[model samples]
Each structure stands twice: as C-alpha cells, then as structure tokens.
Target: MNKIFEESNQVALIVNEFGRFDVDSHIMNQTALSVSMLQGCICCDLQDDLVMQLHQLSKQEVQHVVIEATGIANPIELLSACQDPIISNVYEAPLVITIVDSKRLLQNENTEATETLMDDQIRASHRLILNKIDLLNSDEARQEVIQYVSQLAPYSQIDLAIYGEVKESVKHGQATIDKVNLSTSHPHTHYEVLSYDFTHPISHEQLVQFILNMPDSILRMKGYVQFREFPNEIYLLQYSGGLPALESMGDMKLPTTVVLIGEKLDKPALKNKLELLQFG
Candidate 1:
C-alpha cells in the first residue's frame, strides 16, 4: 500500500532516512525543504528498500530520483530502480559512488581485513573513491598507497579528495551539486588517488617530484595544496599504471586534507609519516 500526493511540479523527491515512520507526509515534505539533500549518506545495505521507495514516490510526477550508495550496501535495488520506466531517449541510471576512508583502511594497517574490504569493493563492480589523504605529511608515504590500490581494481574510475572538507561543501550547498565527470586520458587505476600535503608548504619543483615518484601502494590523492611559487590551491589525482593528472578548483574554503583508499594500506607507517608534517 502507498500514499499518493496530488501531482504538482515536484520534479524529484530525494529519499532519505530523515524521520521515523510516525511523522506524516506533510511534515516530511516540510522537513525535506529545510534540509540539504546531499547531507544524507545512504547506507549500502538499505539501498534496495530506498530504491523501491523512490520508485513509488516517482509515480507522482517526479521525473528523476537520486540515491546515495555510500558504503558496502548492495546496489541491486538502486540498479533496478533506475531501469524501470526507462525511456528510449532518457535512461535513468543510479549513480553509484563507493566512499571509503583511510582511517578504516589504517585500522589494522597491512592486514587481511583491509585487503578484504578493498577486494570486496572491486568484486562489487561500482564507482570508486579513496578518501582522506590530508592526514599524511609527505608524498612518499602517499605513493606507497597509490601503488597498491592500482593493482586491485584496474577498471574502476577513482577519485581522491579530502572527504571531510569537500563532502561538506556538497552537503551545505556551498557548491552546486553537479555530476563529477572524470577524464579518461588517465586509465582507471589506483594511481588516481595520489597527492602531497605539508604543514608549512613546498615549492612547485618539489610538488612535481612528488607526483613523479608516487608509489603503487597509494591509490588516490586529493586535497588543498600550497606551494611557494604556485601560491594557489590544487586538486591532485595520481593513478598507478596510468598517467597522473592535476586540476585546480580555484580556491576552496576547506583546509588541506587528502584521502587514500586501497588494499593492504600501511597504517602505522602512514601515521608515522604523517606525524613528520606536524611542525608548522
């Protein structure tokens, strides 16, 4: 059984676990208007039911539905929801983005658990993300991680960004919610998550070397970068087994933070390496 709303100009209804079932739909609509849609991170396990709910809601003149699959939750329901009411000209696809942080990877550091998580994600066949590389100090430590992630999933397009900072921008509406279109010049590999962070700052020459010497263990890297000559913020992405790329997002209000997501990530070594950058 489903409750129907009178059809209006509501283009889409983003499904989120904002309130308990006790609240009425009118209250739900009011709450939804006040909240930012991206603030909610969808748990992977409930992706199915969420998708089904989205479908039911779509029947009321809503044209598209967006669902976030943030963790290891299976995306079958999400995938199925996108396939229904598939028009020849317009195909609705559930954009699946898998987000994992370095803390989770570093919990045991170089253990089977970390490897298992990465392995499971590769097997699932979805989008990739290596978050939180800003915790590290130097590029060498980050490279070690880049090398390892590239070997795990060669087909998935990966992006590295400081999750805590950039993610908030999406949630807070500081930046427009635009589909991030990744370039194909660089092959999909672990190397995309390569970056450099310094408490003080470094020169452009040093930054270039860091990019060139990126290791295979580090898979992705992205965050605010500060250089002496190039006193601008940079968003960096390095991929093992492929070409490295860097882009500029002008200036981000967020602090410098990078994230690395991969298999068998060296946690202690990473933390020890990050400690070196503590001195300002």
Candidate 2:
C-alpha cells in the first residue's frame, strides 16, 4: 500500500505505535501527516486521534488520505468515526479493504477465536485481498482457498496476490459511501492494554531480552525508548507477529513510553520485569 501511495504521488497519514513519522524524515517528507496511537485496536483506543488527524488533513490540499489500520483493528468501528459530524462533510469511507494471509486461512488447526475475528473483518470489507497465494502449491489449492473466502465474504470483490501484487482494476474500484450505524461495543473488549512511562533510560541489552521473552499472548508492543548505551539516540521499538525491529531517531523531545496490547496480559509480572530494566 505504501508503494501504491508513493507511485501515484499520493499523501498518506499513518497511525502506528513506533511514532514512525517522528523518527523517519523520508516518511515525513512523503506523508501529509503521521500520528502515533496507543498500542491497541485503532477502532476503540485510538479513534479520537484518528479523527483529529483526518480533520487536520481536511485543511490541506491533499487529494487522498490513507489510514493504515492495525491488523487487530475492526474496520467497521474505525469507519464509524468518519461519520462524526465535524469531518463527515469533508471525508467519506467509500471503501474498506481486508487483506488475508492465504497460508493462515488454509491452516488446518486455525482456532475458533481466530476464525471469528477473520470472519468479522471479511464481513466488514467491501473488497478482500487473498495475499501470499505463492505459498500454495497448485491452482487447485488456490481454488479451495477462494471457495472458503467466498463463503465468508460472498459480497466482497476478491483479488489474489503473490508478493503483494494486485490487479489495478481491483485496486481502483469505485465505492459508495453509505452511512452505517455506529456501535459502542468492540470485539476487543476482552483484550488488555498495559501502558507505562519511563522517566529514566533503559539498558539496551535488558530491553532486547525483555522483548525476546515477551509472552506469546502479547500481540503487539511498540513505543519510544531512550537507551542508556545510545544516549544521543531515541529508538522506536516495534514488535509484531514474532518479529521485532528497532529504528534510530536522531533525537526528539517525546516521552520514553511504551504500550503493550494483547490478550490475558499479566500486568504485575510485566511491570516487575520493566522495573528491573530501568537504569538507576
């Protein structure tokens, strides 16, 4: 999607955990705005920030505003924010696209909970992209996958992709902006969010070990950190889907805070571990 935005010379306003816009000058130059939200589903926890960013973007002479929502986010809840009277006149959620991992969908032991979330995402989308089709061995297998998706999202226009490539026709389809009834409850009501503000710097080694040993239930962990070893540099820490990446942001006046979003998080245990990593 970032590639599409770049090729078409369209501006995007990304909302993510690492405060990526503040750290990367290239991204800042390419994007109209970048704001960081708390580590949770954007639909519930960070809807206000999303709306504020949209309102700000409306003031600019931008042709498009792309919001890159998190994987765990419910698109319906996020789109509901566009109905706000303040921005409804200027903005419209004409389309919602859901991307699915072909490999995951084909897995035999996919949990019931996982299926429920996937179904909700599919039902909400106007279009669906069955990505990573290259993982399947034969056309027959692909057809099976398509059959499963059809059952889940019968109305959505389906597209297949390998290595993230998709047809232009599917990408540029026209959509109608219809108003939807907003719901107060969210699918992630059971999930837990742990947020902490670190006044002192943390030992880099300890931070790495902490992330490496993070509980499997923790779906995402991201925030800004000031490391003792790299006093001059502020690092953005992001961990998702068993992979972690750290990027250096030369310097910033932002708070050294981190937020952990997941299910059934043991808060006391996590807080104790973070306390040990703090540099005295």
Candidate 3:
C-alpha cells in the first residue's frame, strides 16, 4: 500500500469482512485505504463498484488502481473487477497478490476442501508472499513450503515476509488472472455470522477470559468497545485463529458492535458468555 501511494495518489479498495479497521493499524497512512464499496457475498457485481470508483478517481487524473481483498475472498473475482473495460482504460493491469500463512498451511487439521481452495488462490497470485515464515522452526521447513507453493503457482514470484511486512515492495508483473470456476459466493455461505452491539462498558478481565476460552470454531472477530476501567477510551479488538489482540482506538466514538465469523456457532451459548463481560 505504501509503495503504491509513493508513486501516485491512485486508489486501492481494501475489502475486508469488518472493513478497513481490520487492517488499518498495519497501514501507516489510513487515508490511503478506501472502504470497499461493497462487502460480503460477491454474488452481486463488484465490477460495477470498481468501475464507479475508478471513474471518480480518473476524473482527478488518477492513473492506476489496485484492489486488496480479504484473506478469504476469491482472487479471480477481484481480478475480474479490475479488468472491467471502464477500469482497464485508465489503470494498468491488475496485480493479484496472495499472502499465505506458512505455519497454518502445514497444520494437520486442514480439510481437503480447504487445500483445494488454497490451490486456486495460490494460482491466482502474480506474487505470493509467504507470510509468517518466522513461525516455521527451520530453514528446511520454510523451503518445503516454498517448493509446495512453487508447484501450485509456477508462474508467481515467491517472497518471504514476517508478520506480513516485506523488506521490499511487492510487485505482481502479471496483467490478469486466469478465471477460475471457484465461486465468488464461496467464502461466506458455510460460516455462521453473529453480531451484538453493547450499550454499556464491558469488563476487561472477563472479556480476556472469554477470549482465552474461545473455541477454535470461532474463526474471526473484530470490533471496538470501552472497558469499565478505562471509561473514557475505546479499544479495537481483533480476534483470529484462537488469538486475541486489543489495541487502543482511544476514545474514537464508534459502534461497540462485535461481529463474529465461525462455523457451527452456538449463538445462545456465545451470547451468554458475552453477557458476562457486558454490564449486568
């Protein structure tokens, strides 16, 4: 993202389930990240939104535009949006970047369906950043993943990154992605999604305990809330893959609604757990 803005003020629409706040901390300049015009269930045409956003930017003489889709988004669908004739006329070819978690891919729990989905995603990348390589214990293990990815994306440049921070810019020289039959409707259908808006301050200690005891089925959660102890400040909560991290959003007034994405969620039970943290 930093690399693109340095060259020009062109736009990059970052589409995440929870919005830019999901990645805002990782970006140095929040202004560069634009909220996606649409989200969740790509059954609708994202291409239209891309065209409209591009036309608006082009009026300002913006030369190029790129898209940053969430981890679970279909790469081929996103690429199609960028190649729409209205956008293609103004910007250069789309760059598809796939960021893979090295440690997670080798885990024993991945289902065959997950593996097949990942293969499609990797093939769509012009540049593959094998992120979290630091999580791998040895150079041999790292090399094993590189070789595995090379087989999947023979045309992509494989690069290493730590915590998703690359030492240099990521450039995908590929002009377009080969369209995959993989459905853009793919990511959300199987997951259970639930959200709750807290009207009062939450107990921090209880919230911490809830996070620690969270089941693996809870895939991702993000929101902002005020703690009873802090009173005046709000914190951003990002929970993923059984880990939770809280950072100060610092009295930035926003909704205290938390959204959870998981499979087979027990909504009643989960709500009971969350109620313990909220003001009684």
Candidate 4:
C-alpha cells in the first residue's frame, strides 16, 4: 500500500494483526496524524471496529480513504466489509486493485502460506495491476506472466506496470514499514532494514539515476532528498518495486534521510552509494 500511495496526504486506515508496536516501522514513511492504525484483523476479528473507523473517517474532511490490510487478510473479506450498510451509504464502492509482483510470483520467492494466499487474491480480484514486469529478462517472459496472471484473474481487468507505475493486492516487502529499529542483530532473519541521513546535498539527476538503476536486492526505500536542483526546498523520495517518486514539500525541511528495507542488502555498500550521491 505504501509502495503505491506513500506520498499521498489522504487519510489511511492501516489494519494490523498485532500490537501497536507493529506500526513503528511504518511511522517514518507516513504522517502519523493522517494514519489511523487498527490493531487486529479488519476482515474478521475487528470487523465492527473497522466499520466504526470508516464511519468516523467519512465524517471528517478527508477526500480519499486507503485501507491497508495484513498480508494474510483476504481481500474478498475486506471488500465485503466495505459494503457494510453504514459505510456504503457514505463511501463509494471500493476499488479492489490487486498488484502482482510478476518476478516474485514467477520466482516462487514467497513461502507456501503467502504463495497460496497471493494466488487466491489474484483469482478473486477486480482490477489487477502486474508490477515489476521490467524485471523479467525479456518481453516474451513478461508476456507469459501476463498470460498466466490473466488466467488466474479471468474476470479482472489487467494492467502492465513497471513501477506499478501503470499500481497491491499481494505484496511481499516491508517498504511500507521502513522505519524499523536496526539492532545489531538482524531484526528479520533474511532482510536487512536500516537508515542513513544525508549530510550533504546531492545532484537531482544523480539521485534520480540512482533510484532508476537501484539494485534489485533493495526492495523498498523512503526518505527526504535535498538535491542541487531544489536546494531551497526538501523533496520526499520513495522507491518501491521499480517506481521511484520525488515530491516537493514546499519549505518544510528535515535532515535529508533515507530508510531502506530489503533481503540480502549490504548495508555498507548502500551507505557508500548514498555518500557518493551526496558528496560527489
């Protein structure tokens, strides 16, 4: 969800499966005030509570509402909740957009439980956006994936997205939660989650290229970027899948910082690259 709409200022209803602490990682990427974290399964355990939250949000001055569910929560159930009489009266019919990471799906990168749920999501989706098709080696491979995913989501309207640029029903990364406390111990057995603060301004073109040609291993990145082009202003930079977006923040200034989450990341090497962007 953050991968697609992290930069938006709209209200977000982020559903969590555990405690409030589970939300710590995502805090850095979002405006805490605009986000309402519901700590439980929105589809099952806390259906009533989810309804209440939606009702409250609808009454407010919010324009759009984004509901992000846990990976295990099925979209069908969530969509069902959106149809609650109270909610439907105020909110428009929710657009259940499913984002498929074609590379990860084809490579079988997910564990069995996650894999099964993801397939089910594709099978029961409305608008399916297949992201990261550019990661495939050739156009033929990408086409095969489109064909395969289309079969699973026969009723779904499919769109080919490189960054998801063109849009998640099923996502595997922690880009949504990049503000994790990086303990000496690997917080995640396979993923290296960490942050770096830019001590100097980097050229806009250089930073843009860095994101465009970012390593495949770096799953997600978010932070403030101070570029030579916009030296007087601060821009927020967010990267996920292959999409990297830079949005201006007017005169608001914070230390140009970056938080990255991914599997098999070399922290030192990443730090070095950012340094080059800043110092060079």
Candidate 5:
C-alpha cells in the first residue's frame, strides 16, 4: 500500500486493491490527518474508472482527494484520483466533516445543496461540520447557521466553532464518536429554545400549504399535525426542503404549531399566518 500526503493541499488520498484493502490502519490515519470525504460506495452511482483510480491509489497509498465540481456529473471522479488509497469497512468509518462560515453570504437554497453534497460524500454514514461562529457579525447570525444545519441534517451531528477553525473541544471525530451524545460549547453566547403553540386541529393540506409557502426567513420547521378526520391520532411532520410525515400515537390535543426559528422570520407576519390557521 502507498500513502500520499501533500502539505500544500493539506489532504491525503488512499487507494486499495480488491484483494488487499487494509481497513483499520488506513482509515484511522486518514481521520487523524485532515478532514476527509470518502466517495466510493457499492450502492451508489459512482463511475468505475474512478473506482479503479481509487483502487490503484490504495495499492500505491493515498487517503483523501478534493472534489469541487461545478457542472461535473460524476462526483466520485475527484476522489478516485488520489495517491496511496486506503480502504475502510465503513461500519466503523471515520467522520468526513466540512467546516463553513457563510455569514449570510450563502443563500438559503445553496445551504441545503452544499450540506446535501457533503452528506452524500459518505453514503453509508452521515457527515458533519462545524459552522464557524465568530465569522458572523452577530450572535443571531451564528444561531441561524446552527438552526439551518440542524434541519438540513437532522440525523447528523453539528458543532459550533468560531473564528474560522474547529474548536479544540470538538476536534476531529470526538464530537460525533458516539453521535447521540454530541454537544456544542457556547463560548460567547447562550441560545434560547422557543416554542409556538396552537390549539386547533390541522389538516394535511393546510400543513402542506404552510410549509411549501413558508417565507424565506424561516430556516427550520417541525411539529405534529392532526386532521379532523383523524381525531385522537396525530401525524408528525418534519421538513427541510420537502416533507416527511410519520404516523405517531398521541393525545392529538396539541395544536399543529410549527416552531420556526431562523435569522429572518418576521414574527408578526408568521404570527398572522398562524392566527389565520387557528381560525380557519
């Protein structure tokens, strides 16, 4: 096996042959180095030459490759071109984290796609990143990034960092080692959790309409909904870009209140929409 490390790019790419893919040593080292993005997945739609390139690199020894595609259809092509490539079992996979700080420059639509691509970089498992906090001019902007990331990646872990670097408290894979127990440190500010309540039965159509037409200011939307026909029952709705409704068993007495938190949600406008829903 060959290992290729380049300080100029701060990346290592690993390649492996089918017969001798070293799982343990290779991946552990990859994690210890730079933030990595793994691209080969048997269940995914990756190209074969890209796979062979990655295989040859593994045989030679490179660990990670950089991919910044604008119009490229094959996302895995960039990953397959690294030096001594290492193979992983994936079940005990190392985390692939992308650190970003948009400070309102990144559009809401772009935020979802950027995160989706980062998560897609590793198919079998989720990917995480620390949205740099200090870069934002205000505390509110930092919190907005956090809320947006949470909705975009409900299953993945997120850490808050400041001044354009990952925090020492949550470096490498330490934050997501167990995933369920991950937490962020509030070095400069405290975040408050807000809840909006409702006292009426919500219809599926109404709920869908509200989400589809939610203002650009809202970053996250989640809560339970109940239609009159399904009384004494409730359906949970979680949405980022689209919608996923899960059947849930509960008192169904709660309103279809969606707690929307973001950087730009005009409370008065949102309140008007909610008030209308209550009477309708």
Candidate 6:
C-alpha cells in the first residue's frame, strides 16, 4: 500500500494504534501526502473514528483516500462501517486489495478456523497480491503458491510482488468484481496487539537477538528504533513469518516505538526481555 501511496498523489489515513511506522517512513521521504493515523483498529474500536476521518478528508482537495486496515481485521466489517449515513455520501469504496504473504501461507499450520479466516480474506478481495515471492527458492515452489491461492480466490486477479513492491500498472488498475457477498457470520478470532515505547537507545545487536528469539505466537512486528551505536540514524524493523528486515531511515524525527500483533502473546515475559535491551 505504501507503494500505491507513493505512486498515487493522494491522501492516506492509516488505522493503527502504535503509529503507522510503515506509512510514517514514506511520509518522511515526502513520497506521500498528508498521512493520518487513527490510533486504533478500524474493525473494532475505531469505526466511528474512521467515519470522522472520512468526513474530514471529504473537505480536502484529495482525489483519493486509502484506509490501511489491521492484519487481523475483517475488511467486510470495515466496509459496512463505511456505509454509515454520516460518510456514505462523501466516500465510496471503489476497490479492495488483499496482499498475501506467499511464504507464510505455505507454511501456516492449517486449522479449521484458520482456513475459514484465510478464505474470508481472499474471497473478499478485489485484487489479490501474492507477496514475498523472493523468499521462494525455485519456480516450482512459487507456482505452488499461485496454484493454492487460485483455488481459494480464482475470480480475483493475482499479481506477484517482491519486497512488497508491485508494478505501477497493477497498482493503478481497477479490479473486476464479479460479486459482493458479505458473510453475515464470521468466526471470532482473538488477536492482541501490544505497543512498546523505548525512549532510551537500545543496542542494535541486542535488538536483533531479541527478535531472533521472539515467540512463535508473535505473527507480525513493526516499528522505529534509535540504536545506541547508530544514534544519528533511525532504523525501521519489520518481522513477519520469522523473517526480519531492518532498514536505515537516514535522519528522521520519529518516535522509537514497536507494535507487536499476534495471538496468545506472553506480554509479561516479552516485556521482561525487551527491558533488557534498554540502556542503563
């Protein structure tokens, strides 16, 4: 979505509690315009907040608006909330895009509930992007992912991406939606998000080690950091499916915070380990 935001000169409203470090990084480089954070998940706590944001954006000269939902969010609930009488006249959802981690899907331990959740996401998407293809070792391995996703969402157009980057043509095109069937009954899946703020600088080596030893229940983590050794520069850390990527953000004025989203997280144990990285 950051790629789309960079390509399209439009306003963006990111809905995340721990500050959208991914969107913030793009805003720092001025590739995006007027990015706003709603500070809660749109699927549950912040539906009204989303309406307010849309109403505010309606007054701006923005041609387009993008709402980046949380990983565990049900997009249908988000869309239904958008239809509220308050902002329905002002904003219309023209497209919905779902980006799938190809590697994660292949490696996921499939339970009945997990399968349902995955299918719901794919079935609701207008455009499906199979991302992290670079992680696949061979052409056959990549094709296997495509085949599996095709069975789930055969109607939607599939595009392969590497490093979360999609082609400009695919980014701008409209998806052909055969139907809009919103499921009334959805299985309740509890996902907890934990946000940590560290004012004191942390050791880069220690941070890497912490991430390496992260619990398997922690599905995704992203945030900005000010390492003691690289105090002059801020780094962005993103971990998904056991793969961690850290990038230098040059010099930027952003908070040093991390947001962890997962199921059955051991918050107390995790907090104790994170405290060890803090400077004395």
State which candidate has the highest TM-score. 6
- The true-versus-predicted C-alpha distance at residue 62 of model 3, in Å, is 2.1
Instruction: Please report, as a residue range, the 10-residue window in candidate 1 with the lowest summed lDDT.
Output: 168-177
The CA root-mean-square deviation of candidate 3, after full C-alpha superposition on the true structure, stands at 4.0
- lDDT value for candidate 2? 0.69
Please list the Cα RMSD from the true structure of every candidate, rounded to 1 decimal place.
15.4, 5.6, 4.0, 9.9, 19.1, 3.5
Quote each prediction's TM-score: 0.38, 0.64, 0.78, 0.53, 0.35, 0.83
Off by over 4 Å in 4: 1-33, 167-280
Scored by CA lDDT, what does every candidate get?
A: 0.42, 0.69, 0.68, 0.64, 0.43, 0.71
Q: Which candidate number would show the highest lDDT if scored against the true structure?
A: 6
**Clash tally for model 2:** 0
Whole-structure CA lDDT of model 3? 0.68
Which ranges in model 2 have alpha carbons more than 4 Å from their true place?
8-10, 18-32, 108-111, 167-184, 192-261, 266-280
lDDT of 4 at 254: 70
Clashing residue pairs found in predicted model 4:
99-169, 164-167
Better of 1 and 5 by lDDT: 5
lDDT of 4 at 260: 75
Write one digit per residue (lDDT tens) for candidate 1, span 107-206: 4443444355455554333445566766546676555444444444444455556833333211111111123222112112222222234565445565
Candidate 5 residues lying further than 4 Å off, grouped into runs, are 1-194, 250-256
lDDT-superior candidate, 3 or 6: 6
> In candidate 3, which residue ranges exceed 4 Å CA deviation?
1-8, 12-33, 42-47, 167-187
| Model 5, residue 123: C-alpha shift (Å) | 16
